[model samples]
Target chain A: MAQQELEPFFFRSGQEQLFGCYHAPGRGPKSAARKTAVLLVHPMDQENIRSHRAYRRLATQLSGLGYPVLRFDLYACGDSEDECELGSIHRWVEDVAAALKELQRRSGLSSICIIGMRLGATFAATAAVEHGGLRGLVLWEPVLSGALFIEDLRSAHDKMIRTFLSKPRSTTPDEAGLDIMGFPFPDRLLAEFKEMGLGQLEGSPAEDVLLLDQGTDYSALAGGLEATETRLTHKSVAGPRIWEEDPSAGLIPQEALKAIESWVAETMP
Target chain B: MGCGDNALKEQAVTFGAAAPLVGILTSPVASVSTGKAPEIGVLLLNAGLLHRIGPSRLYVKLARFLARDGFHVLRFDFSGIGDSGRRRDTLPFEKSSNQEVSEAMDHMAEQTGLKRFLLIGLCSGALVSFCAAGQDPRVVGVVCINAPGFSHIIPDSVVAQVSKRQASRYYLQVALSNPASWLKILRRRVDYLSIGRALWNATFGRLQRSKSSASTAAPDSVAATHGMQTQLENFKQRGVRSLLLFSEGDWGLDYLHCELGKSVKQLEQFGAQLEVVTSADHIFTLRQNQRELMNRIRTWCLGLS
Candidate 1:
């Protein structure tokens, strides 16, 4: 296997310049995937920070497997534009499309594979429907339903507040229209999440979809995939939940990474 | 105003000689080549294992905040953390960490032509800044928030206090006083075993002087504390400013107090400010807390010029 190169650059999404790192496949035609690439969509807030190392490793691993991968920060996230309360899921979906375009332009790949985690997966699946030509998708522990995910976040937020805080404060995240665990999770974004869910969604653009599950009920999502005549590959892998786990632990879901590498190599080709 | 009309431009850069460091430098677009250095460049180090974005993306917000204030900011992962690859060097991690931090300073100096810097970091990042400020002459100021292991060698007095504070008696008293505490314990939200072990170690760990980390007074303990104090005094002598911010609830506060010993108060005599955010946890997980922390930092930065 030839050595891969990571190119970090900023690409435009409307007026916003989003940060992205493209993992270009190694030298030699034997190692490079000439016409196919992967775009990584990160989870929201702390999940984005937590899963960063995983996604970077995944991108490098995928690039090593002959597919160019681009891991990017969505607008108002990571190293991107520093706007507070960037409150629009619809806008993020558009940013995903823009990332795809950037990935295509950078790698000169016509076919794209989007690998999204948690809420990022929800965004990818949503983006796939609006923008065509996505060859495959790997949804790793995707947010099955936005409403449920919000509830989970709410409960998690409440638990964190209760456990860590001694003197109660006035600002409740659910009440204040803001988030605490990094960037602001605006009320508008929370409202948009009410309409998100893989099962509730009408269609999926990608023909082949890989679901790496971490114990979420995917029956309804599977049914939707079946209805769409999508080539579905479901893998149940148990490991550290990198999306929430502390980064210092140096935890990587090796099983998931390997599963993705094998599944993508087999499914995409 | 958040990231005002300064026309901020950010570029991902790779620096360092053998083991390259990856970082994002956010700057006002118009001021890069003006031949006049900005007042100071802020370097945001990694908070624990959370990469350069800091815990809860604190560094990102801070970088933008400082950039809006006309300060060039570089937020980057050290050698092996975040997006940066590990060094294949023979030097130990501590040595490498120190070297790479200096390398970041060099990179910032080259890009912005700024000789002075204000290093801001949380947790391990805080410790890095603490060490860097002592060593690097370019570091004009430091904002160390919740630095764990500020001093590797724990003093006996701190150990005694930690033992007394974290003792089983303390836990028993608290558990007896609050029904909610017991309820949380019942729900497994509070790990009894871990707490039990921690309390046991804290209480009895010092008794076993040979095995106890607090007891073995390494010859360097005096040197380390003195070195740290000397560094702060050096900053004071040189008119360098510093802000030592901490969360009252964080163990790092105790650690900081322990590390500084008596001279912690003398920092204020040298125009350094020490503050505690009563509502914040170690990471400032609350949005309100984050805002307060940022506001405090901004206020401190504004005072610089």
Candidate 2:
């Protein structure tokens, strides 16, 4: 809605200031009464590109429901100020933490939730461990294991290289570095990614979690959170694989959006 | 790797009659060149549905690259795209896009007192630049990268058939050379019927051209070519330098060489320079390809100075 305030600004995350857009609730009867805020975690690489529109739409939908939503770019990604080669998962987790603090301060709401897609879901899970008072977590087609995620990235990278390179050479997992599509994948980041797994984490930090399964069966991810003092909700949502090789066929799954909207309304209320 | 980390200054700007268009102006922090500032400004357009970032942040890098070269570059999203507000005018993209681009140039001129402009775009953006150049005499040069179906007069139905023909012909060529293609065909991953159609077209289709002459002899087809030629001739007459870059790997190469026939050479003789990247993707997604493309652009910009 035009009445909704969309503020674009930069905030500090360690030494670098990350770019973010805040979607505040419109001046409605429910606007001032709302206290819950949601911070969106974007998926890595091309998924970010394909999912940009859907995420913006999702933010608008949430804001219309009187929920303040903040969508920010991770360090070295999107419109943020940095190079892709310098990005690391550990740094991005910190970036998420920084964004959470900024969102809390801006919205003046201590009750916060995180909605992450693909790798963003993984980062959210990781950051939730630090912010123990989170309202909920939404993992949209999240990657359960770091190893499998790296494997998928490698496969996509190889296909893209073979398509683009004149003398395309296959890259090995043990290689010193990795470049998926155009974004650089430093070996240090690769090593950090290889060691991460939702199951391996000590516990889930949130009281409730919603796993919006696009296709993958997240029984393992659910079991890990179930072992902790956490309630895990699983919902199957059929949508376009935004992380697929060719993002040209941009498909925003209406079903998935509806599912997310319904879940946010129920959880945040 | 990105504008030497503050070698250039960038600011978000909104301009247009309705102020519906938004762009980022990337200009050098200090004069990088001693000579008089380049007379031309750069306007980067959206390739297709992609935002102003271009495909794979190519526009961002290009803007910074040109800025470091002491040229002001403006990369903007069109109506209903990226962060730009939607247009209330409800004009078709074909008409509104040219007006929006012109507004961007006018914005740059107002900001920096630069009147001459260079239009750089990929795919659909290239077509927009071509159309915009025809409308504005302030456009001194244009760099169209991998823009295939650029004719203004060709009907959509004809363009669709041409695209299909070019795609089919391309796949047929790939199938003949790459064993991986044959393997995909064997595995039913490749559409065999389309391949067969393409093969037939590539083989007997040319030989059977005389029989199909009646179908293609429409007055519209002739007019489309004539229109395209006249546009190029007009650009030449106006002293607007044109650089047409085609990636050999792109289907656009087929459209340029096979579809446009010898008219391509005629345009070149008319003073438009055509350069082909033998091993580059349609979007130039590869970093090296992007570097090469930027270098070519920098050289062209310098030559203009």
Candidate 3:
């Protein structure tokens, strides 16, 4: 097995810095798939923490198959510079653009693609739409609507209060925004999430698109994708929602990973 | 407002043999404290499976807060937990964590010219800090937040329902006391099997109240408490100061009382302090609680002789 050279660094994303982990493939017979470099945009908030191990594994796995991969923490998220209060959907979208640019600079390859999960996919889609010319895109259970996503989070918070916080509080959750799960959901970000959705997006972001859904219907997202030369592959895998699962090493859905690996191999070949 | 805005500079670093671990080193633009020793460093540990930034980025907030007060801080993921690669050698976490933590101190010393260090952690991280601080004499102080009893886990065959040794959960007491929980139970929303297990745990007595763990093989509750006492005594004899902070709603605080009823006095006798936050859960899920916890930590660090 070839060694994977893992490098952690902070690079300039606008005025601040964003945390990035690069997985470079060692010298070996490269994978048969296209020479396009891959960039992974991760989910935010608690979903980001829960899916971190899985993302790392996915990056490692892709690198092992001879593709250089970059996974990054957007500004105000993870080890990146700035605070959560400083985070915004607009800024996060720019972070995605910056990350894609960084990935391009690091790989020195013309053909490029992206794999984004949850809201990460939404960000990737939004970025691809704005920037254009992605060779391919993989959206694994992408959050189609930011409003509905926030709704799910609000629902989760209600359940959390019922289980852990039995006593009544001096202030209601709605009174001062919400501190869902553990991280604070700033009111500005909440408003951003409510107003932002893929429904508001127009045009296809990539020439080749793969939508991987599990226990959700997001077919409507690509329904109006209007790229004449584009190809869209839709598939589903058997697995529970990983975002809700307690994070541990190797708790990732392997079947879903395999589906991705297979689709990557078949899509561009 | 949370952290890492202006006063502190964060540098990504790697340490340990072969530089296998990844950490963020936070240093203030200028040291702001004149009351305490200025050369002291603070090391933060991973909470449960959480990475370096910590749950809700609590470690980040605390690190930035302490850095503003003129202290160097480093928060890193344990081997195999975050950006850090897996350890090449196969040592279980309980045994390897202490060495990793000790190595963190060594790395801090070698990197920053700091001699004395302080360790901070939450839950399992808290337990590791307690154990590792005992091993390292250079450690001047230790902060343990919501630490569970280091007792072994009772197997499922022996005691199924008491696997967590936690009371804050909604199944047993939380449900029985709260009218809303009763409503949930009456609505058949709560699982019958869980209620049965809770009843069995309740009827079986100390098994639930004692050290409940996830492992099939851990020390008995009494033995674990004894182990903690030995470490507490070790701190006293070595003149190491300690702070055991707990939230009023966490199972860890309840476990502390259950295992050692008068042990709070023992803790005080040995220069170990206990501060329980009234408005927080185990993770201090609320921002106000995090502020209080951070305040307690800063005060304790400043007061360290």
RMSD in angstroms, all models? 4.7, 3.8, 4.6
Q: State TM-scores per candidate.
A: 0.87, 0.88, 0.88
Model 2 misplacement above 4 A: A1-5, A27-33, A160-177, B1-4, B16-19, B31-36, B156-168, B176-197, B203-218, B269-271
lDDT of candidate model 1 versus the reference: 0.76
> Which of the numbered candidates is closest to the native, going by highest lDDT?
3
Best by DockQ: 1
lDDT of 2 at B111: 88
In model 3, which runs have C-alpha deviations exceeding 4 angstroms? A1-5, A28-34, A165-177, A226-228, A248-250, B1-4, B31-37, B151-173, B176-222
How many Å off is the CA of B190 in candidate 3? Answer: 7.7
Better of 2 and 3 by lDDT: 3
Q: How does model 2 score by TM-score? A: 0.88
- Please provide, for model 1 over B43-102, each residue's C-alpha lDDT reduced to its tens digit, 9 standing for 90 to 100: 998887787877777788778767766778999888767777667668876677778888
User: Considering just chain B, what TM-score does every model have?
Assistant: 0.78, 0.87, 0.81
Candidate 1 segments whose C-alpha is farther than 4 A from its true place: A1-5, A28-34, A165-168, A173-176, A180-182, B1-6, B29-38, B152-224
Clash list (residue pairs), candidate 1: none
Tens-digit lDDT string for candidate 2 (A132-237): 7888888888877888887886677666655542332233432324556666677777787888777766667687788888778888877777888888888997
